[model samples]
Target chain A: MENYIPVLLLLGFAIIVASSILVLSWWLGPKKPLAVKLSAYECGVNAEGSPHAPFASKFYLVAVMFLLVDVEAAFFFPWALVYKESLQLGPILFVALVIYVAIFALGLFYIIKKDCLRLR
Target chain B: MNTVDIAILVAKTLLFYLIVLHVVPIMVWVERRGAALIQDRPGPNRVGPFGLLQPVADFVKFIFKEDPIPTGANRGLFLVAPALILIPASLTLAVLPFGDKVKLFGREILLQVADLDIAILYVLAIGSLGIYGILFGGWASGNKFSLMGALRASSQVISYEIPLGLAAVGAVAVYGTFSLREIALAQDGLWFGWLPRWGIFLQPVGFWLFFIASFAETNRLPFDLPETEAELVAGYHTEYGSMKFGMFMMAEYMNLTTISGVMVTLFFGGWHLPFVADAMLLKWIGSQNLLGLVQVVIFLTKVAIFLCVFVWVRWTVPRFRFDQLMRITWGRLIPLGIVNLLVTAGVMLWLGGWK
Candidate 1:
């Protein structure tokens, strides 16, 4: 817990420095809002729809795929750290990793096959 | 722990902040000057000494400039976003070792701010949170383009992060430790009397994957779909102006340094140089304080070179289309990263396992 003092201190320093800049700019910088300027930028035309409108499912799919792949990748870290130790226990760990990766690969293949990753 | 220990820690943390902030202006100068050199033009020479004062000038401008929050924008979130990005980006620097230690007046001072057991995990977790700054800035802007930019940045970050983790798995397999200092110490000796026992030498594919993934993760050129002015008009920070924008920019450069520092710590031996053992240098120097300073210099030099590479790659490569970026992350880099992990495991297993 003592080791975390510096981390917390650094965090405090970071926040102080960052917020000081924001506050400085706020205090010093001029502010004069116009409707034309306040409106969302849209290449000179008025914005057509709400900014919060739903986007494509491709984006959603990409995010979901990230979850699947990222979690698998996370699991790999501990496994890698213990690979040598676990290998001494038996070849079972190696076989388990093989099966794990195979399943992951199969899912990746299926995703690719379905074109779930494509933007359009 | 004690008065001296607390004092040293405070001093180190202060020094780290100063150095990182100092690097921001230097990096700004280098990126502009380097980008100019790449594009065959003179860049910012009119300001103090080859545009050294250009960042100062920009800072002044940012301070005096008007920062108008849009009519429909969420003012609170719009104001908070830059700080979100800046803090996390700077926070990751706490765990990275610039040098081993200095023996000062019968006491020892560690070069790093913290030596946490979960240093790498801390870095990954904090680094990922940096995207929220972009997300908030985009969403609060009340702009279509800003939202698009936020989506792009978040998705790109998430996609590349998988490969980045996998790449680290290979390195962890080699080192068996998450502490950056321990990893650096492990690479102190030469591999074959000439070659350094660096991660790059042992895990070439892992290094490559990490390098490329870091590049993408930083939202740099060739992968800067988040901020491609041609499409989303300055991307996530479209509505931000003045120092709010500067904070984001500062955070970006800081993130670059953080990533470069991590790469150096992980793959390039941090402060370790080829064929020159620290013990030999320490003996020659005869003063641990001086050795610590020298080690810090060497570590900074390597990070500086990589930062230049980041700038160079930015100016050289064409920006990838969003789809291509995603496909590369999902298709090529991930599988290769997995393969690298497996091969590294297999070889380490065959080579008597990790020591």
Candidate 2:
């Protein structure tokens, strides 16, 4: 736990450095806001509608897939750490890992076959 | 811990901070000059010798330029997003072991900001948080392009992260530890008295998977679809101006440096000189402190090479279509990463462990 103190200190240092840079620029920077300049940029044309317009559902699908795949990746970490030691359990541990990965691999294949990742 | 220990800790943290912070300008210089060299153009030669002062000029320009919060932009989130990205990128260096320990003032000091047992995991956790910066910047800006960029960036990062983490797991399996320092130390010595026992030799597939995933994670080209200038017009930071934009640029370079450092520590033997044992170096140098300094130099040299490769690849490859990027990660890299892990485990098991 004590080993983590430097990480906190580094985070604090980062905040200080980043904020100072922002503040320095904010102080020195000119503030002149024209209606045109302040408008949302749409290739220099009059901004059409709200920029909050709906996007495709493929992005949301990616997000959901990320959650499942990311969790599976997380499960691999502990197993990886103890893998060397677990070799003492003979081929049983390797077989379990194979089964675990095969399940995820099958899911990945299903996602592919469904063409859920198609951007268009 | 005593006062001396606390003081050393502060010094070590500051040193690592300065190293990561300074890499930004140097990399900016390299990226421009390197691009010019590749394209046969002079590139920023008017500013200082060999355009070395271009980053300084950029700094001044960013500071004095007008900053506008676009109409309908969320004031709070827009302001916080740049720092959100910068902080996590900077904090990752804390867990990287730049070198082995050095005896100072009768006490041994490890040449790392933090010696966490779960250093690699901590790095991944912090790295994943960087996506929030892009997400917030895009959503807060109230711009369609920025939102598109943010969504793309988020999905790209999260997708590559699976392979990245899996690759690291492969390293952990090979080294039998999660601590970056231990992994580095384990990589010392030679195999068959000829080849260095580096992680690359032990886990070659893991190395390639990690290296390729790192390009996506850092948003470097071929994988830089989120910020494709022709398509997205600077992507998630389209509405950002002045220092906020500068912060994003700085954070990108910082992430590049941090990722490169992690790559060095995990797969390239950290600070170990090839075929040159630490004990032999200590005896040759006749001082532990000087040897520590040498190790840091070695470590930074490896990191510098990786950084150059990043810039090189950026100019060499064309940007990937958004779909292609996602397909590569999900359809290819992730499965390859799993296979790499299983193969590593199988080999270790076949040999009854590397010990």
Clashes of each: 0, 0
DockQ of each: 0.71, 0.81
* Regions of candidate 2 where Cα sits further than 4 Å from its true position: none
- Report the CAPRI category for model 1: medium
For model 2, the DockQ equals 0.81
Point to the candidate with the largest lDDT.
Answer: 2
Q: Write the per-residue lDDT of candidate 2 for residues B1-355, one digit (tens) a residue.
A: 9999899999989998998889999999999999999999988898989989999999899999988898779999999999999999998888878899999888999999999999899899999899999999999999999999998999899989999999999999877788999999988878888887788888889889999999999989989978999999999999999988999989999889888988998888899999987888889999889999999999999999999999999999888888888888888899899888888888888999887
Give the candidate number with the greatest DockQ. 2
Error of 2 at B238 (Å): 0.8
Q: CAPRI band of model 2? A: high
Whose TM-score is greatest here?
2
Model 1 achieves a DockQ score of 0.71
True lDDT of residue B333, candidate 1: 93
